[model samples]
Target: MNTQLQVKNNTNELHHILTRLENESTRKEDLIIPARNLMFHEDGFIYDRSSNKIDGYVLNEWATGQFAQKTNIPSKYFRQCPPELKAVNANHWIKELSSDEDWMLRTMRSRDGSPGVVRGIMSDKYVPFDDIEILNILDDVLAKFNKDYEIEMWNRGDTGCHLRVTFPDLTTSVGKLTNGAPDIHRVGFHMMNSEVGKSSIRITPMVYRMICTNGLMGWDTNGDVFQQRHIYLNHDEISNRVTGAIGKALKLGDNMINDLLKAKETEIENPYDVIDQIAKDNKYSQKLTGIIHESFDRERGNTAFHVVQALTLASQTLNADSRTEMERKASQVLNKLVVGL
Candidate 1:
């Protein structure tokens, strides 16, 4: 006997495939980040979301607003910024010009027939640095440490430019408490412009979370960063400074490796205790505390390494200044856990 084969509906199959393709093509959500609002104060200063004040003196409201617009920070934040945020002083906003005998200012009649004192000329020259030049400098410096160094990401906007370079050769993985859960370390360079209204380059020592690929950048030591002024464009000086910074960073990285190894060996049955201690010892924000708790809960085991990783991930969510403070506190907490060991 001969059997007849039945064919499925070709039209229906084609329609289903087309629908799936369409869904895949339009799945991405459009995300828009708003510009930061910088506040301008009557006393001539700008402030971001922090309580600290920027060291800029505005001679008039028009100048202050111009500075605020240029800086792009909210007016409220700048006005309410606290004194602690104030640096001793900075000439970042000020510009110097050479005296030229040929240049002369046109005569201006003062309002109300009164003579006004000359306030001097505003600077017209603003120094510019090529982003590529800065990256080349980083490339030269990072190559000495790791030949495999490569730029992982690049971001730029009104805030300024940011380049993240990764060093695959200088990585470390350690896990003694949980045999399968090894925390990985990836060293890199995070070079950027307009970091706190100044150009800077730094050794970005970030840890990789085993579960999630979050680059925990809460451990940027003071010794790792080098800030430079645009006006002082000295390649030799910058190269020398970068060389010294790299040496210090290598030493810091070695110490971190040792500390992480110790952390892996140290056991903690209840990781929440560490989180609680950290929260109490250092007035951590609710958001930071919440992230820490989540990190501990998500971690597979109770170990000092996991606790440190958790805290590190939490610190990344903080604002620029707060992240630095949290990283220092986390370091202190981790150190306390393995003081003798």
Candidate 2:
């Protein structure tokens, strides 16, 4: 058979099987994650009858916990589900596990939805860039920065990859310093591989603050980040897209540094008053307010620049919903103060 004909046949077959699985009353309890690895059983009821229907089924809590610990899925969803058992309620729990980067889904069924003796397979391995490709990309970009920047690999695991290229001890003076200011800041660009809803790669820009040492992405309102996704595995086209993005990313980094330098020029005579006003205006939590105060003291003084840094630090600690809110609020506050508000 032709490749196209075979592909169409496979699609129709999968749909037919899934329809049966969805309709079968007993299949709900019998359906496992390919192996007996995970089973959805009736809660607190013993399986004493062959024809017993599953009114409601939950994942085996203890078994799922053990599986999570072994597979390391528990930590990945730490913010969403600190307790691994709660992950059962998450959307498509079995599907997510089956589609995990490190594992594949297996099944034992025929094209007509019969209980075949042999098991089949469904694999999910959709990495845009492998280790060799990533290394080559970094090599090309690092040469653009010369030997002035330091390279750090934060993560290069199964899920995603991150690289931070920083220019050490390179900073612009913020505000007029009469008593000799400190040079403790550095500027950098963060390159990462992130997928939006497991769909496509979304290109983004990050700003690194020395005080908190947080590399926050999508904080700037410059619209410098470009979002792109590869529809096909065409190496040349993919490389070209990334190469073009690299040039734009460097320009965006420069623009971000320039903006920070401009903010530094607008000095605040009473730093405490401005900080207090920001806290009250934004209704910052008590914990966040305390952290901001600690950051102010740790940085050893206050300027418009320090205020930006402190708030950015606070945003890092916030929950996802609040973090986005804080990023917006910080921008508004900084814009007002930058023009001597």
Candidate 3:
């Protein structure tokens, strides 16, 4: 006999036996229960808890016949009556076999769905500039600043140069200063999450908006736009507008405005710092920052919503390059957050 064929035949035999059990279950009203239970003891059979014909002997027999034909197995094994068949109940066999099969299937499915890397795109648009010109300008800027960086330009798509600068690992100390001002453009370096501790930084879609608006208005800096606005030169007004816009975009509470502002102010150096400070400042009051921190601590995981919110706040506050970096980082983190969940 062919080995493979023999294995196939053995499988068919098991299937046929199961089918016979099903058929026998349908032959007698009282015996239907025991027959159904016997059928459940075999592999590849699911108990239909919703079915009301558990006492239908003829139906059970028909089902068993179908199952035996499908599996290509003989029914004699199932029909055999053991010496202690009445003592060894069918329900006992069913409970054990069904549990094992259920567990095996669950394990197989779980192994198949493990998390993996996620990818996303980050895009930003800026004023039309000659690729060579932007490249030269970027080279000069990096050189003048005594930094190591590279620039690449694309002329056809967004009508602007695409510059990518590689920076050294960013520390909490560096990120702390980022909150105070837009340092990336001048510094040629920015912070991102690292496996060591902090989060990674990458370009985000907000970079496009920032670039388009700035390019349209001919402003070198986002702060320039704020300065040009004909508003009362009061910290409260500026802070409120900045915080409110970001809060709305992020879907955070009004009280979180300060923490968001502070995070933006510090250039998103340390999110934990912002959370800690907000918690301290709002010790006697309601603050979103504290709530978020507590929630994160409780879950021991990050949420896409919070990451997106942070990206929005960063866009509102950071300079073009830094904003782009934050967006990229947020995108990267968002993927992990989604997969982890």
Candidate 4:
């Protein structure tokens, strides 16, 4: 999926991330960096004092990713080079390729205090939408649902931020579990936002599988996808859309449930052949394909639903980004594999 997942989807884990963001919101600083005068180092970059910026921030993985993309360098390959070489190449490209454009580097205070991680990097026009604000608005709207809903999960980090909420009372049964109990899916909405261009602010329908804790997002199937770009967002408009999103998503949840039921019945005679095809079509590495193959074996169900189950089950163990990607792939495959789809 284009939307990268985040670590540990729980209220407490994300609350910690939120606390950090809150602290940064008050102490955060933004600087306009001119590529020509930015000096690259092994772990961070320095902005020349002439630009009226006297400090530079330590580069975290997120910051490195931003720098790599702006300079058109693969982060893995760039990091593999010797420090001296990395600095030279980074500076060269930063000057040659991005000199004409200015980048806003957002930073938070470090433990020892001088300046810390690069929280965000973007152009001057990137709008600053505080994660705390988004969550507060979302919480208010969710309370109006009045259905004993639970904030299912949350993700807040430099990479991106996300929120998922589900109503336990709002669930539907699909196939049978191994113990013969019905497989239940609960409906809710998945929300994501990234002020630094990690992702657009979006609200979409979500289906959560109770059996394996798998999530399927972006399946409104019958309503508007409320996605607002950071460049232009009205808080009131977003609140209205988010309120409407949950109701619309719940109403259409049955449509997705029916589709999933059909997919469960649609058998895949040659699962290996299908798996191979997906790997090739998506250009997934042999290593990743092998893992999926193993997961499929573990699932041992000869239907398209099993294929999706394997992917999501595997995702629970993967890193944040990889897990999101696997979930997205599973959703896509399920859509394509459904009968009469």
Candidate 5:
């Protein structure tokens, strides 16, 4: 079966996948600094040294929130403070309250409105298990997946990434295609990671629609195929864990197929209601909620499968992290209706 490239994320189109990842790896600079050495400046965080100060380390949204939490202050209140007040609050807390242990500040060169952005602040023990390194480990597990599997979809951004690869031999038929052919859904994996402390490295099952290039990633009641936080894990241990996880994912293909088949048969009396509720319950932004409605209208299918497909289709244009979240939510919608699959 030919793998369909969804949206603009084809691996070949990206010049070279590993090269792109290597570029990301190069842009990062991780520093381990004592909490007491930290201070906040106007619109940035500072490394306060009397003789030689490093002040360009601006806190990105995530890092700012983290810093606020660390200082025992609410992020909203912290951001609203005057520049001098912010510094005072930050310095006072860092000096008086913080422990002596070193903290890791994950930073990137200033870009996209963030100047020398500290994307994450974590304990010094936080392992730097980023995407490039993890994929290298997978190379050993799946023979680099060069001969059999293909990287059909890719989403990359400063926040995180989701890589979707297709498994040709593990497809199952579901629904009907636009060309009067059986709709084929293939089993695959959605490898997700966050270098900026957004999420743990995770592998979830993927359901890809060959007909319309729609794909949804999800966790069943069983959860991810693999999930490991970037903490206290040595290289050898993570490698062993990844090898076992991928092996298990390949063998466990039937659940996703069964779910899609059931979704195809299950009709929703009111998709909009369900969609609206799910989006609201999940605290989806107004923009994302609108996308789902538009996708549903365009697809014009009444079955639960169609609703899920609409969500996945809508997700195609989102940023990597948002797309992953949207697809995960779509899968939950399908799962809620026909669970055992």
Candidate 6:
């Protein structure tokens, strides 16, 4: 007797097949993991997510993001890279095949935005030096390249060291290089800010560099291969200070001008109050009284110029003393306004 074979379509069978396919794909193809999970070996090779595989390692998205952030590279470009490929490409070790460190030194010096080319000399016989010592050597080599720019070190996450150079123009540029390697890459921007009425402008600049090196064990690195710098202006604070200065200058009026001069040695809360008291005691004109009242009203948006214009129009029908006082106050306020700007 022959037996017939039956096909099973059970939920458990379907789930098992799907899980197997996922595992196979992940194992065969490059698996993209978060930067936080990455662990670097002593030889400079990175550990893959699966302990069994050496090639399937995680990449540094945060380092790449830091590069994008400092260089002002568009977010669209970073997002364009495949998530797995981005991780691998960003975190890969830089292996220097050539015995000549000239290429690396020339690249860093030329990009430093300094006056001349900077040359690097090998201090020790070892191919892979300590990351900290290498950074110090790079700093010394680049220092002669740009005397006007200030160079500093930056560390982005666990990736590597960043060489930041600030220029006199208030602009900064960062050089991104692997922490312990000599490979160099760069990125950054310029920024400017100014008060609405101020004559001066504040500027800031940034740059980036990336470094990598090869040796017997593999590639080792130290600093950030990416970096950024920016300048900020407090516009609201400037405006407030200007407004206060203008208001203080307006309180210098004839009725209180003498009193103010007399009490200039003393600190008075409201200068306008001194003027108002004098106007009431001397039976000042209604137009003058109205002008003083209007000037003192903090709620009104009337600038000193507007107050003067109104006073001038009403002065034609008022006494000489009141007219002269309004004209004097208006002139003083106008001068203050122009100078404040």
Return the top candidate by lDDT: 5
Give the poorly placed runs of model 1, Cα more than 4 Å off.
1-74, 77-132, 143-146, 152-157, 160-162, 176-182, 195-201, 204-211, 214-222, 225-233, 268-270, 280-282, 316-329, 339-341
Q: Candidate 6 versus the native: TM-score?
A: 0.16
- In model 2, the runs with Cα more than 4 Å from the true position are 1-135, 144-147, 156-159, 168-184, 195-224, 229-234, 268-285, 300-302, 313-341
* Superposition TM-score, candidate 3 onto the true structure: 0.21
Output the TM-score of candidate 2. 0.50
Error of 6 at 70 (Å): 32
Give the Cα lDDT of each candidate: 0.48, 0.46, 0.28, 0.71, 0.75, 0.30
Clashes in predicted model 5:
1
Model 2, range 116-189, lDDT digits (tens) per residue? 21111112333333324543555555565464555422333222344555555444443443357543344555
Count of clashes in candidate 1: 8
lDDT of 3 by residue, 301-325 (tens): 2334343344434343444444444
Reference-based TM-score of each model: 0.53, 0.50, 0.21, 0.82, 0.82, 0.16
Per-residue lDDT tens digits for candidate 6, residues 1-341, read: 01111122223332343354344323222223333334444332344343443332322343334333423445467557665554444344222122332211110112233322111211122132222332333334334334243333222112222223333332211211224333222222111111111112211122221211100000002211111111232434433433332222222222222321222233334545544554576576666777656644521223332333333444434433333334444334333333321
**Residue 238 error for model 4, in Å?**
2.0
Error of 5 at 162 (Å): 1.8
Ranking by TM-score: 4, 5, 1, 2, 3, 6
Q: Which ten residues in a row have the lowest lDDT in candidate 4?
A: 1-10
